[model samples]
Every structure is written in structure tokens, then in C-alpha cells.
Target chain A: MNGDDLFSGELENVMRWLSTAGIVFALISAGLIAFFLTRRPGWRMTPPAKWLLLVGFFLLPSTTMLLGNVVGFHRVKTSCAECHVMDPWISDLRDPKSTTLAAKHYQNRWINENPCYTCHTGYGLAGNLEAKWSGLRHVWHYYVAGVPEEIKMKRPLPVKTCLHCHAQAASYLKIEQHVDPEMEPQILSGELSCFECHASPHPRKNR
Target chain B: MSDPSPPEAKPAPAEPRRSILALTIACVLALVGLAVTVLHLAWPSPLMFTLFMVVGQGSFAAAMAVYLAVILVDLRRRKVL
Candidate 1:
């Protein structure tokens, strides 16, 4: 009963619906374009023909393409696991005995859904897009330079990623280390990492 | 009298080549979007995810631009601009 399971199941249904619509519209649109492409545009430039083109080319495909990303990208962890390099991290997440921050959060259900994306996306309204674009960069790197043998984090873990959830928590505020005025600004300003005090975010066994 | 007033082939349409080019490009872009969308849905990997999000949405936008251009040109020809 992982939260991701429930959310992912819902997204799966939506994705199926969207993909079906995308395929249908794409077929119709392409077929209609071909229809007009081969024949005389002047001869068939009727209002109905125009309507067909509008629906086929503009309306349907636009909706389908937009929704496709939503239903498709919403399930980031599932998508992340597709690459072989991610297998160990994903395995650690699922391992009951693993003590890494990611594993603890997963096992404890601290993150209700999209645990992978939520933790890694840093913080912003565009955080999702940032993460996705970063993923694209990863894809480019994987195909080009390949994952470094160590598969290290590309950037420092954003403090805001932790603050996004924990900053306002009563338990988080009550922590003795957090109350230290000298360290508070450093944490907020990204000078110090929470992991230094807490623990490393992930296991260091990447290969 | 050797073939007085000989026949001649009809002239082609005066419309520009880019009109057709735009239509063709739109179709191709749509097909690519469709293929990429399906691939993402099928696999849902980061590569496909990026493609669907970027290439897929981008294809639709570019296709719309070209298709809209074609429509605008037609409208202007009819003096509706």
C-alpha cells in the first residue's frame, strides 16, 4: 500500500485514455493531411474540410500531446527505474532494512507520492519542470559521456527540498540543532547541508 | 499547314511552394509527436519522458504554427486579413 501505488494506478488509467485519444487523433490528422496533400487544396477547401483540418491538426493533437505529458510524467519514480544505473538506488528505496534517507522516507511513508521526484526536484513552482529538464540532461549524458563510474549527485542537494516539507513541522522546529542561530541562516542560505548533520541522502554504493 | 494553333499544357497553380511545405512539415511533426507520445506511454522511461515532454509538445506547437500560417495566408488571399 505505497502511496505511489494508488496514485500511479490512477495515472495509469488516465494515461491509457490519453494515449488512446492521441493515437486516434494522430492517425486521423495524419490521414487527413495526406488526403489534402495528394489532392488539390483548392478543390477541397470547403468549410467542412477546413473544420476537419482544424480538429485534426490543431485541437485534438494539442490536447492529447499536453495531457500525454501529465499522465506520462506524473509517474516519475516508475520512469526513473527504467534505466539500469538507477537499479541500486531504487532497490535501496524498497529495502526494508536500508537506512538511507530515501529508504527511510519510503519505508516510513514520509513522502506520500512521487517520493523520488519530490525529494530530488529542489524547490519552486517550476520544480517539476526543472527536474524533468534535468532528467533530459541526464538522458543526454547517459547516451553521450555515459554515467560516471561512481554515478555521483550532479549538484548539491537543495536545502529547500528538505525545508519544503520539514521547515514548518513542529518536530523539525523542536530539534536542538535546528535552534542554533548560527547554523539556522547557514542552512537557509544553502551554506550548510542538512545531510551533514542528519546523514548522507543516499548510499554510496553506486557503480 | 503544319499544326496551326498547336495545343499547349495548362499552367500550374500560382500559390507558393512553402504553402505545401508547411502542410507537409505539420504532418511530419504530428507523426513524430504521435510516435514519441506512444513511445513514452509504452516505456515511460526518462528518455521517452523527455521526448514526450519536449519533442512531443514542441512538435505540436511547431505544427500548429505552420498550419496556422497556411490558414492565415489563405485568409489574406481572400482579403480577410
Candidate 2:
């Protein structure tokens, strides 16, 4: 179970480091810049000050922000819930009595950490990149174009999203329909979407 | 074209007022970004995350652009480029 808690503790440590060292470094750089501003110009600026401005102020903080966003922020459930549109789905995912596939996984801890991201994001590097790209597009929609009333996937759900795990599982392999030559190609080609058989993963109301 | 006006030697390099201001602004932008990013990391939210993604990263970009312009101008003026 300790290994399962990887998302729980390691993220806290990252947060603590960023809030402490990260904030302090930026503040210190700001103070130094202010101090340098008061001094007479010309050749008064020492090389050290320039290096501090370049590295301490700019380089470190930018890298830290990128790291913070990708590593830890994406793992938390509320990170997605932060957008009001996702509230209904997050609530359903948490509801003990909810019969949704997502809720069952959540209650059972089948995916452990970041069940939302895990299910939504497909497997592998391309999938990860696509997820991040979609994330950016979501922000653009939320702010510039306005969010749609009923959220819908722009494309057919990738069967790989479900198959990456399920394909090897005994429950899935044992099913005659899954291994049937007739059904297998349809599933693989995504002509037959996984959820078509499994039904709704989340309720209709995203809220 | 033969009027003999003296070519005065370059005056003492004046203080880099513009570059200093640029760096100052850069500092402010970066600080605000760092703060918002930290806040979001502490408590997750779409609002804060959006700010972090937009304002926070936006400030960094603005700051970097200013820094770049300042550096280029300074280098050109000094004939170092």
C-alpha cells in the first residue's frame, strides 16, 4: 500500500519544496533587482547581478513551474474539478452508491491514483502528448470560445484507452465475445466502441 | 562636405535606465507568476490552474521578451554584437 501512496506523499513533498525554495528564490531575485535599480547606472552592474537575474529569477522558476504542472498537479482529482463543468462527473465518481464504471473503479481503487486522468488519457507518449494538447484546447474553450453545454468527445473514444488494461485481464480474455474473430477486429478498429457494450462511464449531467 | 567639426569621443556610458526598468518589470512579472503557481499547487482549482497556465506563464513570457529586447538593444548600443 505504501507504493500505492506514491501520488499522496511525493506530491506533498514537491509542493513543500516549491512553496518554500521556489517562492523564496523568486522573492530574493525581485529584491535584488529592486536594489540594483537604486544604484547609479552605467558600469555599476556587476556580472554576478546579471547572472542572478538570468538564472535565479528566470531559468529556475520557469523550469519549476513546468515541473509542478506536469508531475504533480495533473494527478490530483480536484485539478480537473477546479473547472466547474467537471463537478457533476467528479461527484458521481466519488458517490459510494453510483453505478458508473468510473465510480466503480474509484470505489475499488482499481486505477489507484488519478483515476480520472488515467482513464481519460490514453496509453503511451503520443497519448500523453494528446492529453496535454487537449488540456490546452480545453482552456481555450473555457475562456475564449465558452464551454459547450453538453461536453462531448471530438472524436470516437480510442478503444486502446480501455484495451490497454483490459485486453490482458482474465475477465476480458475469458469472454467469448471479446476473443471472437468477428468482434475482435471491430473493437480493435474502434468500429465497436468499448462503452457501447459497457455503457455510460459517467452520467449525462457533467454539471 | 569638408566642414571640420570635431568628432567628440564617446561620453561616459550613461546608466542603462531602460534595461534596469525592463529587469524590474521582469522581476515583478516573474514574482506574480511564482505566487499564483504556488497557490495553485497548494490548493488545486480550475481558476488558479488557468491563472497559472495563462497569467503565470504569460508573465514569464512577457518578462523573457522584455529581457530579450533589453539585452539585444544593450548589446547593439555597446557594439558588442
Candidate 3:
């Protein structure tokens, strides 16, 4: 399907998930209230009950967000270590491997701290920025708003951000050996990000 | 020991206070969502359209309805005929 079709389908799925989650949240909130009421003898719900229920409401979303943060942190750490460099960030990345080639994204400067979402847009279990913003609007999302309403805002790295430090010393023995056309029209026109084609940047057999 | 007024001691029922506040917030959000939706329908700017549609104005309506339902349930439980 076309991009528009794909985006629409994805949005429908997202709304369905939100509906399910909202129902679950409401159910759990009610269950906790029931449990709390049962626990207290002759509990006519003193002022403390209000505070307790409010705290639980606050904690519900906060705990979910904290868990999400942990998972995101873990993913970035692991992904960065797959083919990271021998440097400060890479050294501290989740898992380090000296054996892998230098072409990995872990070695890339942009992905160093940013991780997968840095390029891969959209929210899911991982969270994604909606297509409501893209193109000039995306630039505005970063530059104008300064703060994205839907998702966390990340400052755009320097021009040629991904390639600036990535196209550096190749860990491979033969540096010239590569795949895909070294140059593309899209790149010259600044129409595409490096991740569009060279997502992982791993060299294949043919260019 | 001091005698306490029924209003002070009873505290106007927690259910009504909580439900009213939740319902009011839900209503206000629903109205804002609706306003955004109307504006998008008229002007159709990308930004405004995004604000209204993808954010799901309908979702806000649904939330308000749920809050109203909760208030009804609480009212019934409290036996306010």
C-alpha cells in the first residue's frame, strides 16, 4: 500500500490500542478502589482515602512511563553495542563487541545516544511521532515549537549528522570495497536522510 | 470533645466532588477538541488539521462520556434519587 494508506491503517491500529488501554486503566483503577475499601473496617473513606486514590491515579501512569523508559534505555544500549566504536559512549554502551565490523550504527555518532527512534519515526510499544508532522512541518517541530506536543523532542544534530563521523575509518581491511551507489540524487538534493537507504550501514556484496 | 456540624463532618460526599471535577475537566477538553475539529473542517491547514484529527477529537468526546458514566454509577451507588 501507499504511504498514506499505510499511515491511516497504522493510526487506526493505534486508536484501537489506546481504547483498549484506557479501558484497562479504568478497570484497574476501580479494582484498586474496591480492594482499598474492603481492607479498611468501617471505612467511610476519610480524607486519607481521597489522597490515597489520587496518589494511585498519579502512580498508575508514572509507573507505566518509568517502565517504558527502562525498556527504551535497554534497547538503545544493546543496539548501540552491536557495532559500536572504541570510545567513551560505545565503551559505556550496554554490550560491547570488539569483533564486529565498523559499519554498525552503534559506531555512528548520531545513534550514539539517540538510538533507533533517532531515525525510525512513529510511536508504538516503542513510541512514534505521528505523521501529522513531517517535511517542513518536521523542521518546524524541531525549530519552531522547540517542544513536540506528542513525543519527546530531539534536537537535530549537525548537517550530515549521521555521515559526518560515520564515513570515517573503515574497520574492514579493504576500505574501497562497498555496496550501493556511493552517491545518489536524493542525497545531493537533501531530500533523504542517510538512514533512508543505509539504515544499519552494513556493507553488502553488491552496490 | 467538641460537637461537629453535619456538613463539616460529612464533607458533601467525596463521590460528588471528585466526579464533578473530573466531569468538568472532561467537558472542557471535549469542547476544545470540538472547536479544533470545526476549525479544521473550515480552514484545513496542515497544522490545524493535525491538531484536530490525528489527536482524535472523538477520543476526547469518548473520555468525557466515560467520566459522565462514572459519575452516574457513583450517583447510583450513593442512592441519590
lDDT of 3 at A70: 34
- Residue A178, candidate 1: Cα error in Å is 1.1
What is the C-alpha lDDT profile of model 2 across A1-207, one tens digit per residue?
Answer: 454554466766556655555556555655655665566554334576777667756677767577557634454433677677777888998899898888898889998877778877877888876776687678778878999988888877688888888989999999999999999999888888988878578886664
Write candidate 3's Cα lDDT for A1-207 as tens digits: 566664475644444344344334434544554554454433423456545445333344233223322332333322323321223334433234432232344554435554543543443433233422342254345446663333423543222444334445364223333223554434434455554543333322222
After best superposition, candidate 1 residue B41: deviation in angstroms?
3.0
lDDT of 3 by residue, B7-76 (tens): 4345356666566456445444543444444444334343444454444345454644755575476667
lDDT of 1: 0.75
Write out the backbone clash pairs for model 1: none
- Interface RMSD for every prediction, one decimal? 2.4, 3.3, 12.6
Off by over 4 Å in 2: A1-9, A43-48, A70-72, A75-78, A82-87, A94-97, A129-151, A205-207, B1-18, B41-43, B76-80
Over A11-116, each residue of candidate 1 has an lDDT whose tens digit, in order, gives 5666666667666666676677667667675544567767877776777677667667666667665567777888988888898888889989989999987788
Candidate 3 residue pairs in clash (backbone atoms < 3 Å): A122-A128, A123-A127, A123-A128, A124-A127, A180-A207
Residue A184 displacement (Å), model 2: 1.5
Name the runs in model 3 displaced over 4 angstroms: A1-46, A59-64, A70-188, A191-200, A203-207, B1-81
Worst 10 residues of 1 chain A by lDDT: A36-45
For every model shown, what is its TM-score relative to the native structure? Answer: 0.82, 0.75, 0.29
**Separate DockQ for every predicted complex:** 0.36, 0.32, 0.05
